[model samples]
Target: MAPRPNVVLVVMDTARACETVHERYDYLSELNRLAQTGTEYTKAVASAPWTLPSHASLFTGTYPSKHGAHAGHKHLDEGIPTLAKAFQDGGYETVAVSNNTWISEEFGFARGFDTLYKTWQYVQADIDLGKIARTKQGTEMIHALATRLAEGNPVINAANAIYGQFFRKRTDDGANRTNKWIREWLANRNDDEPFFCFVNYLEPHLEYRPPKSIAERFLPNDVTYGEAMSVPQDAWGYIAGTVDLTDRQLGILRALYRAELAYLDRCLGELRRHLEAAGEFDDTVFVVTGDHGENIGDHGLMDHQYSLHETLLHVPLVVHGPRFETGQVDDLVQLTDLAPTLLDAADIDAPELRDASQGRSFHPEAEIPPREHAIAEYMAPQPSMDALRERVGTSTDNIERFDRSLRAIRTDDEKLIRGSDGTQEFYELRNDPEEATNLATERSERVDTLETMLDEWLDTFERADTSGEVSMTDATEARLEDLGYLQ
Candidate 1:
């Protein structure tokens, strides 16, 4: 068989389709380029709210329930047919470089890759205590910038760096460097076999640490009236504190966010340039997506790991490269479908892949299925629910509030979230963009309809068999610990 397209999957952490440079920021021109050059899915949703599960869903084309990694720290089941393994079986060389501990080798994320990298150039875990940026303002900006950059919104890059007092961009630990690594990887690689590379950049995850010049640039003057104070370090269940800001502060916060995104965009642009120059662009299948969305202060929320608001659940997914048409797709797609789509696009029979995986391939001009929703779930992976709670409070830790465990499904117009004990919440997206109103008490008929759908969906999802303990590895334990996944 002819060599299939080389696949380079870039999973930005919190990217949104609507915020791409195409939608707004010109500083992030490259992302717009990618979106315009290939197929963009405006309705894509990450299968989960956080990294590990969402990534597992992305890599395996399966949901959290199907893959069974529901907590902060868990590994992918090595037994499952991961995208890398499946592609490798079809004679492709696969590699992954990730900056999040959630995706470290300790878990199954590294299972099928020929090479996997999870540590960031500057992981928060290893921050030099003395050098660490500590002010709430600094942290808030950092969180915002990091989120913007990580989410593939490059417009925020410069703003983040500039706001953080940066006079010039740093290449060593900056977007340019990340792209350089990818360029080097692609340029130096001499494999005759088709190759798949997964490069996960982490500039955009929270506590928003960017380069030195990026964190300290914001202050009270930059904040809006509403955001003049830092949101408490800890707030709602599963919610973390943010650089509290009022409406006036949004400009600074947004500046930081846009700056970070711009930075990453430049980085991605460089990578794309290299890929094109190397004559690899048209021959490769390129993808960009986020694990989930971050809540940057909507509904009084600071960052992600909080409520299942659209700000947290809706994500960006874009497919470029070869064999895909240039157009927009509104069909609802879960992150899990990524694995199969890539394989199918390559026209390679993925033996390790299973129909049970939640992902389905999207071939250009093909009639897609009619699945109307996606599922996201969260739970305590270990006995130390408190450990997870400390970072993002759960009911076990915050009994006065609601339970932390939540399972939700989202459709185009509405969303439904159900707590384990049957406490439910509903929202009308068109009216409640902030998700401030809970309609479960008021919309009985809608709740019933959604509940039935949820039940049937759960049954179908369970049949996928993503349960039980992940085959453990010391690496997984260490990574989980670093990411606060393992206590």
Candidate 2:
């Protein structure tokens, strides 16, 4: 039998399809080149709208509901087999470099990794004692206090205004740092053993302060980080109709986001160059994808987990390797499909999943059946909504709507979003790609059929026994709060 090819999975955290590849963003040249050389799934969907669950789906080849690693259930069950374990069982070395705390070893994400590098662990080591509290426990307490003080106090707000500027400088860019580590690993790893490398790049996530050189390329010379930070940290003020931002300020925010993407693109190019120099480029299967998309003021939401809109669900999935057909694939695909596809590419059989994974390999040369629709789930009682409402008053109806759990199903031309509160929204994607209009009332028949299909599809997965809030260390919780995952 032929030796398995080395696998490299790149997860661009908070990267949106509309911003990265589908639109006129020329900064991602390397990714574009990969898509041209390989296969690009034009319409790929994530199984969840946020990190933990979406990433679990990608690693386990199952939906958030099946794997039960969503907001309702904060950890992946140990019983569920992951793609890393499958590869390891088949004699492949598995390694991971994750930036998000939710993907840390504490959460069962390190189950099969031979070498796991958590970027946050390194960040904690480099933290300045003066900027943050002296001790880890003290820092956690300060974070909790800050959360409380941020509610409505003018003094705290003023302090936050000042602290926000320095905060951007406190942390190093995770994507660039991770790429450096990957290059070092390539130099040290065994040449004979095939390896699976999982990298999570956090450059595109919040607090978008690109280096001055990168930022200036996108913005005017006069713009500064202070001007960008002038907009509310989470833009909750804009969402709740409290603070009004000038047109120039909004443009600065967009510029910062684009600048970060540009930085990420450069880092990706560096990784590609390193792989080529090591003579591993030809023998490696490269898969680049986004865990979930972000909402940059789309649908009046600042970040993800607020809504299951296309801005937060549609992500880029590009694959390049031997035996893969090149060019664009128009069929609908999910992030969950990536695990099985990677395993299949290596000629490895998938392990017996707890709730049989719904993903199928997209090996283009093979006669695999295409999916007609894609599903995404969001189980929310988002803690951020309360903080947003407290800072800026919003309607109770809006709050209720944002708090409701949601499930979405999308076809090539249509989408249905069903909320737990019994509210439904349907959009004709061809005409309303932005999802500006909700036609649920007008297209009752379509809604009914889609809802039935969603229900039937969901029925296949066995319900996980665990369902509750995730337990976290004080320091971990503090880190999540700093990242805006906690209130």
Candidate 3:
């Protein structure tokens, strides 16, 4: 038998499928090229709309309910087997280069990694700068310092003001830094052994600040980061109709997001180049995908947490390797499937859990039945809701309205989103791709059928016991706050 191929999983944090690979934006040129040479599951859905749970599902090959690393329980249950663990058990060198703090050693995300290079450790200064910039007082203090530094030269002062007000100094180039670490590791690793590498890039997440060159390519003449930051940080305020933005401003936000994607595309290209130069490109299996999608302005929400809309659940999945065929699959797939698919590619047996893996391999040669529908869930604790409302000064009722636990089921042509508060929405995806029209009231039969399917799917997984609370450090909380996840 041929030697097992190396596996590289790149999880692009908060990248929407529509923006990255879809025709609308086409911002990820490098990824698009890789798709041409591999299989692209165009309709991949994430198990959850947020980071921790979705990543847990991706690693565990099960729903968020099974692994139970969500808002209520912030750590993955150690009993459940992870993809990295499977590879490690199979004798592969497991390495992780993660930018998201939720995927750190403290969260059980380092279970099977031989070497884990967390971006935060290398970029603490950048994280500190981001935390400082998120507050009004901190922004004012930075502005004062910039003003003082630019007193000698008028041109230098103007540049400093723009830097202080609009440009965030990114001391860490997220994926670029991770790629450098990966390349350095590859140089030191033994070529005889196969490796499983997982990388999480945070370029497309909140407080979007792309390079100026990239930002100018997509944005209009007047759109500025200073202006975009002026909007309320609390997405609930906008969802509750307390904060309003003009269409042009929303357009600017979208442009900023696309620019960030563009910047990430370049970084991915750099990583690919490094792999090719190392002569390991052909022998490696590469899976590039997003943990979850981001909501730029969809459904009156700013980031991803409050809704299971297509903008948040639908992510881009591209699998390239010697074992995979090169074609596009329109079949609906979930992020949970990635774990099994990757394991299948590596020829490793998936570990058994309370529930059998809900994920099926998407490899073209696999004889799996077409997935009928995909489900996504969201659950936020009452304390988190209260804290967010206190920070944003929004009413508890209003915040809770959107923050309630909910489940959504989406088929190829239709989608149904139901909240714990008895609010439900259904859309015929073919005609209402944007999901603007809610058909739950009009189409009773369709709602009943889909709801039954959702309920049956829910029955397959046992709910995890989250009685043991997981606490994060103060620094971790501050980082999440800067990313707008805590606030």
Candidate 4:
């Protein structure tokens, strides 16, 4: 019998399908090359608008409402089984390396992993500190020390003061560190057991600070790197209508966003080379996807929240393995489907997993099942109204508009977004890909049908039991604030 293939799930945080797959950059040749060797779902949609809920859906094979991990509830309920848990139960060595603070152990993301590494805890360029935190236990010990310092441990004040300088200067957001750890793990991991590794690259997320050489290609000839960095990376300001970005500023933001993705593409190529050198590239299953996308001035928004438009919902999904078919698939697949599909690849019979999941596996050998629509949800306002007001130091009438929850349902050609306030926006996606026009009143019958479908689909699952509150360390909270996810 053939050995069970090892699996690696790579989540490119805040990467969109439009910028990466639909209208790919020349520098994204690595991603494009990977897509050619495997099945690339062009119409893949995320389960939520942002990191927490979308990742929850990916892990549990359920929607935000079912998983109970959304803006309203920041923790993944302990009742729901995760993809890593399933793989671990089936005797696979499970590992996770996350750059985003949202995917940390504090949020219940470390449930099934034998090893979990927080990339930020390790010093980026400092050789001595890197050696100290190179191993898993060393990494955790270093993180615990930092957390103690963050919580006002006076005994290590001098050491904390020194380490804080290196911590704040970490600019790459763990792309290099993630790859380095994976390379080391591949070299040392047990060859007898099949492994399941989940890795997240956060370079494409906010505070777009790509390397100068790569940023030069995306920026205008006249715009200097210093000028590009001068633009405010504040999403709340744009949403609240407090800061109006000039056309030039918007262009610079967009350019920087693309440059970040380009730099990540280079890192991804480096990872592939590492895997090849390890001699496990052909036998390993590779799943590359994005949690969600950034707005970067699209629809007058600077961030991913406050909307479920295609820009934030549609993301790239690619699966490559010897058992999978090659070429592009235009099917409307969701990130939720990935869990079941991967479990199937490992030949694990998980009826409980299948029963809990609302998604169907799009395995290559199986015929493409007809999918009526793709659904997305924003269960609650991220950062909250009060938090936004406090963060921005004032409020706007426009801010009240995004205070409500949003649920969206989309077919092949059209989409209907229903807000908690009973307001709805309808768009003809075929002609108006940007979603510039709201045709809810003009197309009443179509909107009604879509709304009905969304309601019926939502009625299928009840909220998961989320009884506990999620608490994070001061250092973790600081990281979230720096990433623009918190005030």
Superposing all C-alpha atoms, what RMSD in Å does each candidate have to the true structure? 9.0, 6.2, 6.7, 5.1
Q: Please, what are the lDDT tens digits per residue for candidate 2 over residues 21-134?
A: 653566778888888898888898998988898999998988877788887778888988998888888889899998787887767798888988865543322121222332
Locate the minimum summed-lDDT window of 10 residues in model 2.
125-134
What's the lDDT for all of these models? 0.64, 0.78, 0.78, 0.83
TM-score for candidate 2: 0.88
What local lDDT score does residue 149 receive in model 2, on the 0 to 100 scale? 47
For model 3 the TM-score comes to 0.88
Worst 10 residues of 3 by lDDT: 122-131
- Please report how far candidate 3 places residue 341 from its true position, in Å: 0.9
Model 4, 1-487: lDDT tens digits are 9999989899999998889884245579888888878888899999899999999999989999899998778988687888888898999999999888789778889988998887765332211232222222556856745554444443444243345445534558788878989999999988889999999999988889999999999999999999999998888988887788899999999999999999999998998898899888888899899999879888878789999999999998888887777788887899988988888888877677778988778877556584779889899888889889988888778888879999999988899999999999999999999999999999999998998889889788886665344676555566677788763
Can you write out model 1's per-residue Cα lDDT over 83-176, one digit (the tens) per residue?
8888778888888877665676656677778876433323222212111121225667567545545533344333433422332123422345
Q: What's the distance in Å from true for residue 401, model 3?
A: 1.2
Model 1 Cα shift for residue 191 (angstroms): 4.5
Q: In candidate 3, what are the lDDT values of residues 1-487, reduced to their tens digit?
A: 9989999999889998888765445567888888889888899999998889999998888887777888888898788888888899888999999888788877778898887876654322212232333343666856744544444554444443344334434633367678888888878889888999999999988778777778878878776656655645455566556778788878887887888888888888888888888888899998899999988678877888778899989899888988778888899999888777777787887556213567887766678898988888886642376676676676756676765788999889999998888888999999998899998999989999988998888787688877555876544666676566663
* Deviating ranges (above 4 Å) for candidate 4: 22-24, 123-171, 465-469
Clashing pairs in 3: none
Which 10 consecutive positions of candidate 4 have the poorest summed lDDT? 125-134
Q: Model 3 misses residue 371 by how many Å?
A: 0.4
Best-performing candidate as measured by lDDT: 4
lDDT of 2 at 294: 80
Model 3 segments more than 4 A misplaced: 23-26, 123-173, 222-237, 240-242, 351-356, 381-383
